[model samples]
Target: MKKSQALYRSVLIIILCGVGFMYSQSESVYQQVEEAVANSISKGVQVGQEALPIQLETLKGEQVSLDDYLGQPVVVNFFATWCHPCQEEMPIIVEMEKRLKEKGAAFVAVNMTSQESSKDEIAPFLQHYRATFDPLLDKDGEIMKKYQIIGIPTTLVIDENGIIVQRINGGLTFELMEDLVIFRE
Candidate 1:
């Protein structure tokens, strides 16, 4: 009986230790996420770097490649229709794109994987929000992962050579993105 009791207590201790280790690892992960988000929110460097080609599925189920826009300045923002910050910035984004139309910039909104939304649901959401820019549906988050996106409303400004000049992690204003996209004086 004594030996059996010792074995049970040892097993219980091992289980508790395992649980504690798991909790610690989880906390570390959260900290890393927070730090990453913080770094993204800070003033982003004008990276002046080229981006690798990545393909995404369009809302119509056709494959779209970023390389297709290689010669133009592309502004890509990752968002969700249900995301309020995303909604709040749509008007600004639309205005920015409109104001800088002659600069050959492409302002694109890539919607996140929304379990509750289909292409049908997205149409009304786009119209209701006055989002003039066509929002591509990231149905499987494959595109999102390509960019290592960890937060909603992340915007990337790719230069004419397919280089990612700016990576803005948070919401951006029309004025701000316009400057990044180089709206002509």
Candidate 2:
């Protein structure tokens, strides 16, 4: 009985050590991922750089491309339905859309659906927010990777000349949107 108890204790200690090692490794990995995301966002496309070409399908099944809006300023927003910050910024974007469209500016919301299971929540979410701009779906995350989108609610303001003017990494306020739309360099 004494020998058996010693063996069991040894096994238990080994198992606990293994668990602790795995936990620490997982925490380290998580921190690395966060750092990678931050680095990507910080090093993403800068102002004065030509906007990257984007070819994606809208929710209405229409294909849209960045080239299609070359003659006008464009607001390209990356978001997910499950993101609260993304949701919070939707109304402000919608207002921006309405106000900016009247001035020949295009606002395009791109949904990050690649990591999500289904996009069924999109319609209801848009309806709830009264969003009129047809959102493009980044189903395979190609657009996200192309844009180096490390986080949701990242927005890019592109000028009529196809140069990126501003990049926002968080929820946008109405005043900021207004300023971005009105003050173009």
Candidate 3:
């Protein structure tokens, strides 16, 4: 009877240890993923009442700045070819662009530097997706670093005066995007 009790105690201790180890491992993984996503979504115009400065390259290799669009509302979306959420959201963004353009709004996209892709690779992705907007190449990730991008799909809405009014993190549908782009309080 004492031998059986000892054996049962041993099993219980082993099971408890296993449970503890599993919980710790799961927590570690969760934190890693959370940090990664936080890093990607890290780049934004600014946090409340402050606007981020603008200076970035265009797809055609032209230098552009927010000052250039002073009199027009501008939408800047940071996207990557390999990100699944970005791919799913692109069509909706395209439609949003179309509707905004019809309302005289301007929009552009910045393609984050991708080790998994080249400009050649990206061109086809854009073409196949029917994304009509010019996608700037952040090949060196300098802009990404500047923006502090921790994530794939992020957006900034700059008003006519060139002040960034809203920065949306993550993928958004057309209607929600429209609300951000066209409406300004």
User: Which candidate gets the maximum lDDT versus the true structure?
Assistant: 2
**What tens-digit string does per-residue lDDT give for candidate 1 at 1-185?**
99999999999999999999999899899999999765554322236555655576666577767777877788777887777777788777777767557666676667786533655777787788576766677777766766777877888877776667778887877667656745546
CA shift at 169, candidate 3, in angstroms?
1.0
Clashes of each: 0, 0, 5
CA RMSD per model (angstroms): 16.9, 18.1, 16.0
Give lDDT: candidate 2, residue 64: 91
Query: Which scores higher on lDDT, 1 or 2?
Result: 2
Give the per-residue Cα lDDT of candidate 2 at 118. 82
Q: After superposition, which runs of candidate 2 have C-alpha atoms over 4 Å from their true positions?
A: 1-44, 181-185
* Model 1 lowest lDDT segment of ten: 41-50
Candidate 2 lDDT tens digits, 23-98: 9899899999999765554323667677878889998999999889998888889999898899888889888888
The CA lDDT at 170 in model 3 is 88
- For residue 101, what is the lDDT in candidate 3? 88
Query: Weakest 10 consecutive residues, lDDT, candidate 3?
Result: 42-51
Residue 34's lDDT in candidate 2: 92
